[model samples]
Target: MEFNLTWILLGLPVAFVLGWLASRWDLRQVRADNRQAPKAYFKGLNFLLNEQQDKAIDAFIEAVQNDPDTSELHFALGNLFRRRGEYNRAVRVHEHLLSRGDLSRSDRDRAQHALAHDFLKAGLLDRAEDALRRLEGTAFEAEARLALLAIYERSRDWGQAAAIAGKMQQAGQGDFSTRLAHYLCEDAQTRMAQGQFDAARKLLEQALATAPQAPRPLLELAQLQQRCAQPAQALDTLENLARQAPASLPLAATLLVDVAQATGQQARVQGLLETQYRQAPSLDLLQALVALDQHIGVPDAPGRARLVQHLDHEPSLVAAAQWLQGETLAEEQYHPAVQKALDHAAKPLTRYRCAACGFEARQHFWHCPGCQSWDSYPARRVEEL
Candidate 1:
């Protein structure tokens, strides 16, 4: 107001000095923050390497507070929460990362994948499935698909499993033909259980066509054919199975006998069994032959002799148990107890065992119940294995 030029010039330098001081203060504050964040991060790393998870988590929390924009810190914290069984916290952390608009594409995909794992670990299958589905077409696509396949299998959703498997197959992930065939066979079983025999047969046929070299579908189709009163067709299927997967004939021997009897092709089936036994010398084939002998009223001594001859090949306790059942020991009174003990010992050997998990079952399985592995259980019994 006074129009003093001297005072105006002095005021300009004062303002410049004040502005420089403010800038220095702000720079110091930022440098302090950067130094503190690294110190906290390094402390967390040290704690983690020392296996002190609780203290490490606390240090990481401090780091994250210092550098709230760090996505890697968030991921580390989320993974730690998951590993510590704090799935809810892990989910929240990952979800927060996903909600941020500034996240990179790869980081967002990572967050989604981590969230899905959290849901899966928490046993929230539906939520896990949804999260996993969002990861499709991302870098995690194959992993997501595999996890989805496991979920579908655990839920017995064979149709969904098949669809995922088909996608993976088309993607050239691996040869899923055997797995796809398993899904079809599983669906066929469900159809059979619902008394939809025609549909079941069609599914089994499709399974066979999908993987002709696979033994599971062939065995299932043969059994289904036998159940449908198509004895001739059943015999033909079993015959085809014997030719294609001769190693799996033990799994189908009893069915083959039944089919042979139903179709009055006993001699042909017996010939097939004899030929198979000569090639593989399976106890099951011998059992089927003995069954055939009994059906025709052959003398008991010959069956016992046949079992004795089996000792020349594989020294099977089961065969010895069978042979002892017909043998007249010196002490006939002790025969019952001896045979009972031997039979009991051999019964365990007759059970099928999963090669992968070592879970044993009285019946053979294409899919292992213990470890959820497909084709883990061999067609042969524990004794043969």
Candidate 2:
């Protein structure tokens, strides 16, 4: 029994020493792994600071492989892939992060946003839309909704766009009255095309009610009135537009001329356009004035003189071109060549340019086709602007 007791005492110390050694070995392994993680992370950061994104991505991937629990490393790699336009790989990385159970709620939301961005960059709009929709109710809700708004606009789903805009407006994002009115007007146009005139009129009326000062609805209503052969009503609507949205009168100037000529209200129409022109002189408004006078049998000399007066005020290439169209050039032989050159030069200047993206178009746009911004184009032509 004594011998057994002596052996037990000796074995206890040996076991204690062995346990301490095992713990030290484990601690060393953990410390080494922790140290390696930071080292790899710093290496990636160094590459990133040098703008070597490819190498940075490689290092970050290595870091993620070693420390699979590190969500930050995964995020970095995913973002790197996205920046490099490797959307598929970025999507894979973010999707893998989302699949991990260890990710926190915020991290999950971030991963979801990243994944959506990847899908968007890859032109996988359907996938992006699905991913973005999942972000609703989270902190990413506003951002997601904004992206969805843009997506809906791109798809020309005016109904969905209006719904999203309504939500954003409710959330105090910004005033979307004008945007909503535009959507209603677009729907009204579609309904009119489908021969649903009453429905179209109702929608346009709703648009005007939504934004009292908005010119588009009144202009559209006037157009609808003209279409239905209600020339007097169209003229009244345009006159109201001139009072309510004077700055946008140029957009509806041609319509005003048509309605006035139809109703034989040339004198009243000329006064309205002239008043607008005096306030905000635009080439369109001037042209409308010239047309009105010509329609009422004004002499050719007076019309030519009006063009000269506009050129003096605005110094516009377009006005000068118009004036020259009727004038006999001093060098009659070279007149055709000079006129052709002037027309060529004025052609670009005559285009309406988007204020947001500088995309020039032959016709004015309420919404820019290139940038997809509402009311991005100024009513004035490029030369006037």
Candidate 3:
């Protein structure tokens, strides 16, 4: 039963050889599996680059199947699905990623973000909001807050919008004071509609305090004052607006005329309008001045005469059209047709246009309906722009 040294040595080498061969075989199998995943991934990338989205999606799906545990592949597939507007599939991929216990904190946040976007794209706002709320204190917090802000704005939930905007402002994400003011003004309008005059006035005052230089709050507050039959207060508010933002006079010019007539401050408002017109000649200012003159019965000129003077100063088609309306033409029959044509041409010119999206409306908008941008529309009319 004594052990043979020669046999023992020979068995040792044989065992070593077998183990080496086994390791090499396992390595080749691993390489073969990796090769399939990589090939599919590359094919997906190629298809994507070629703008063949359907083929790209198929290739990515194949890649994901080959490498089921690969986090990067899962992320890629989810993003691709989202891009293709397949929110359900995208949500499934991201949810699967979240279910994996091996995922890092950052990767989990990323998956969560992807899932939120999936919900958002699918128009599941309630779920999307919940998902987005979870991203707070994560890297995507700022983005999520902005998304929530947009949702609030779309829903006309001014209070929620204001809250988000305030957070963003406090975070130094960007200047949201003007946006905050707009939110307050919007809420004030709602209150005014509800016959909560005092509440609306307080909100507008808060808006003015929130952004003193913003023109909307001042103008809105004055309008509310005029509605409350506090014409003197409204006139004072408008005068403050003029002093603060002289360039925004056109927006307040009509309001000023109304307040002036109400408060018997036509002479004072005429001085302000004349001063503003001297600084920047706007059709609105000219019109306001002419109206004031007509109200006070200025001995210098009639409204038509003032329009003519504006024509001399600016050579405006709008001015000419206004002046022509009151004048008696030599061919009275042709006057109606000429006036009709002029009115038609001048109609579009009176509209306010958004600087951001070129959305034209008869009334000016603080927020652009087309592009959802705030302060996009200028105070001046389309013709002035």
Which of the numbered candidates is closest to the native, going by highest TM-score?
2
Q: Report, for every candidate in turn, its global Cα lDDT versus the true structure.
A: 0.91, 0.91, 0.91
Candidate 2 ranges with C-alpha deviation above 4 Å: 1-23
lDDT of 3 by residue, 148-242 (tens): 99889888999899999989989999999989999999999999999999999999889889999999999999999999999999988888988
Q: Enumerate residue pairs that collide in model 1.
A: none
Q: Write the per-residue lDDT of candidate 1 for residues 214-265, one digit (tens) a residue.
A: 9888788888878888989888888888889899899888997898789888
Question: Which runs in model 1 stand beyond 4 Å of their true positions?
Answer: 1-26
Clashing pairs in 3: none
Write down the TM-score for model 2. 0.93
RMSD of 1: 2.7
Q: Give lDDT for model 3.
A: 0.91
List ranges where model 3 is wrong by over 4 Å.
1-27, 299-301
**lDDT (10s digit) by residue, model 2, range 1-385:** 3457778888999999999999999999999999988999999999999999988988898788779999999999999999999988998899899899888999999999999999999999999999999999999999999999999989889999999999999999999999999999989999999999999999999999999988899999999999999999998898898889888889888888888888999999999998989988988898898888799998888778788888778788878878888888678998888889888888899889999999999997777899999999887889887
